[model samples]
Target: MATNSTVSLSMKFDRTSILGSGGYGVVFRGEWNNKIVAVKRIEKTNCENNKGEDALQKLHHPNVVKLYHVDSDIDFRYYALELCQLSLNQLFNGDEAQKNYQEKMPPEKEVCLQLAKGLAYIHEKGFIYWDIKPQNVFISVHPTDVENVSMKWADFGLGSPLNDRGSFSTTEHNTRPDNWLAPEILQMKENFNRTTPLRQEGTVKSDVFSAGLIFGFYLLKGRHPYGSQFNIPANIVNNTPVNLKAIEEKKHPMHAIIMDMLKKNPNDRISAADVITRIANIQ
Candidate 1:
């Protein structure tokens, strides 16, 4: 059932546990209407007329996280969202000691296909998922069948429309491991003497680049395409090329598609639609 936008505080729900906390806000697990839900509480200052809610309102895709309700009064804003079992980051870096059971990683092809479909849909909707990392990719848990598990794109705090140029700043730190930012975004931080205006925020191709890195991480069992020994930001600024031969050796079938997505030049990168087609062909 669709959640009413005007739900009052009197609504019966139990806050189960804190899901996660970040610079933007805190996410909590809650039981509402006999269903598990994720409730994100953001300060009024951080909520820009509920932009995140507006972005997610019309979106309905299997690979996209569902937003059930948005409620606000004066000082605080709340978003009630669909609850997922695990994030791709959690699955990538499993803690057997804590969880008791060992984490089983999904097939690279399966992960790639789902992610591509989600990204393609976002692009088609004229929005850019500026942040596309394992942490933002969530997986639905199924007790009986691992293959039945599915992935969905979550966390729209950094998302913006394609034409929204002010979403990103050129002076900010660009290449943190947690960010998984594209080379173009990293380059914006560099002092380049360019004749034309540089793009401060991410474009569709920028999202594609991040998607490639995520795909590489999955193929290499959570290891980034660029080795951990070097600073990723420095490598990106220095125009260090990805080692395609090594990637091909690791996952031959996805080599071409991933390579195209990782192209340094955004104009030269393949479209999300093209990526979907390529993935479909391989499947």
Candidate 2:
């Protein structure tokens, strides 16, 4: 029902309560026409190009947050999304609910299952989400019933749609994401020069690395991949052999397959299909 209004300047409401902040923009929960909406006001400098608007509009999936409309004028750029209400990250990582006090939270198995289904749909559409952190997963109540809620992915800033062959590579961002980046992305040799192709900077495998890290983060209770003893910065700089030897002390059922996906060798990593198959079989 929410469509972009080309002439309605009044719909641009000022809702300043901060939802989140990042390198590009600040998200806020605001109201327009008695409806609650979350607005992302990206800097005009970025909006001048307008891929953000096109990206949000192109997304067509139930598991992805829907774009209500966009309001961009000479003064500012506003991207209005259906407010998520809350995110899975805040529920698990915040307060004593799931972090401290040992407060019981939702079934981890169920959450993981939902995560896989959403991912399957995304991959089916030839899209790869570069960032898969918990902070990007949101929970929103059903429009008719506030008590019923659903999980959805948020943030499309760094995400990219796969090309016809389902591949894109990059090498510009060699700085390892430490616990999250896959080994090939962290170590694979690439030809870098002034005229080097852009795809070489990142790849489908890079996304796989990030995906493995999210599942690992889930199984590890939001701790760094390695605890305190290991030096991650050292591993990043030297391009030497690094292992989860630190977190190895703990045994998680998801460890084996996930680590396969995170393998330093891109060819050894599991595909997203394998991830879905594993998710389906997990008890």
Best by TM-score: 1
lDDT of 1: 0.71
Q: List the residue pairs that clash in candidate 1.
A: none
- Listed in order, each prediction's TM-score against the native is 0.82, 0.73
Model 1 misplacement above 4 A: 1-7, 10-16, 97-106, 143-146, 164-179, 192-199, 239-245
lDDT of 1 by residue, 215-239 (tens): 8776766676755646665655554
Give me the candidate number with maximum lDDT.
Answer: 1
List runs of model 2 lying over 4 Å from the truth: 1-10, 32-34, 47-49, 92-105, 141-149, 169-179, 187-200, 228-230, 233-251
Q: Which ten residues in a row have the lowest lDDT in candidate 2?
A: 97-106
